[model samples]
Target: MAERYAISSGSAYEEKYGYARAVVDGDRVHVSGTTGFDYATMTISDDVAEQAEQCLRTIDAALTEAGGSIADVVRVRYLLPDGADFEACAPVLSRWFGAVRPAATMMVVGLLDPRMKIEIEAEARLTR
Candidate 1:
């Protein structure tokens, strides 16, 4: 079995939830559902597009720390409470993933925090 490594974004929730933001085992890195809240400032934007961008930023940071890049992502999952909000986030999603074109799934689901407009999770394989 490969050794497991945990990555942290220093978000308060990680401590409360008892889970790392991302984890690495061998060549693959699995990032947990990331939200729009900026962990550093603990602030979340009301705009869905902005929230989507923040989700990608948080995911990318975790991937980078795990020795991968957004380009290495093989899968992505998006969660939004409102189905209509999906359209608002398409451009932001495209901005980060338009070229990579990883396998993706988007669904309408209620998040733990009502202030959260979007949540994103990703998986990446390290490439040397």
Candidate 2:
């Protein structure tokens, strides 16, 4: 059996929700839906684009700790409550994923907090 590991962002919600920021099982890393809040400051921005950037920053940290890089990402998911916000976030998304070009999906759905304009999740296979 493959060994499993968990990484934490130290977000309050992780304890409240009983989850880790990301989990590594064998060579694969699965990142949880990450919001815009900077876990260190517990602050989030109102602008969706800024929020999108923060999400990637948070995910990147998790990925690096899990022994993977953004380039190793095989899949990504974007979640937002407003469809119009997608366009605002596109440039940030493209900046991160343009070269890697992972399988991607976007969905407009209610988030756990209204202030959270966006949430992102990702999956990566560690490079051998």
Candidate 3:
């Protein structure tokens, strides 16, 4: 079996929910569903585009802590409560993923919090 470990972002939810921000097994890192909340302040934006930006930022930090970067992301999933909200965030998503161009999927689903406009989950293979 490959050696594995967990990485945390110090989000309050981690302790309350008992889940790591990311898990590294061998050279693969799986990041959990990350939202747009500014973990430090626990605030979220109402705008979907702005929220998408924060989601990538959070995922990037987790990937970095796992010894990889967003460019290493191989798969990504975008979750939103409204399908119409996705277009407004397309440019933001392209900005973060244009070059890496990971396999992707987008789905409309109700999130845990109504304030959350977007949630992103990613998987990466370390090249570092």
Give me the candidate number with maximum TM-score.
Answer: 2
Quick one: best lDDT, which candidate? Answer: 2
For model 2, which pairs clash? none
Cα lDDT of model 2 by residue, 1-128, tens digit: 99798999999999998999999999999999999999998999999999999999999999999878899999999999999999999899999999999999999999988999999999999995
lDDT of 1 by residue, 1-128 (tens): 88789999999999999999999999999999999999999999999999999989999999999888999999999999998999999999898999999999999999999999899999998995
State TM-scores per candidate.
0.97, 0.98, 0.97
Q: Return the TM-score for candidate 1, rounded to 2 decimals.
A: 0.97
lDDT against the true structure, each candidate: 0.94, 0.95, 0.94
Ten-residue segment with the worst summed lDDT in candidate 3?
7-16
For each of the candidates, give the backbone clash count: 0, 0, 0
Local error of candidate 2 at 7, Å?
A: 0.2
CA RMSD per model (angstroms): 0.8, 0.7, 0.8
lDDT of 3: 0.94
RMSD of 3: 0.8
Per-residue C-alpha lDDT of model 3 across residues 35-62, encoded as one tens digit per residue: 9999999999989999999999999999
Q: 2 or 3, which is superior by lDDT?
A: 2
lDDT over C-alpha atoms for residue 101 of model 1? 95
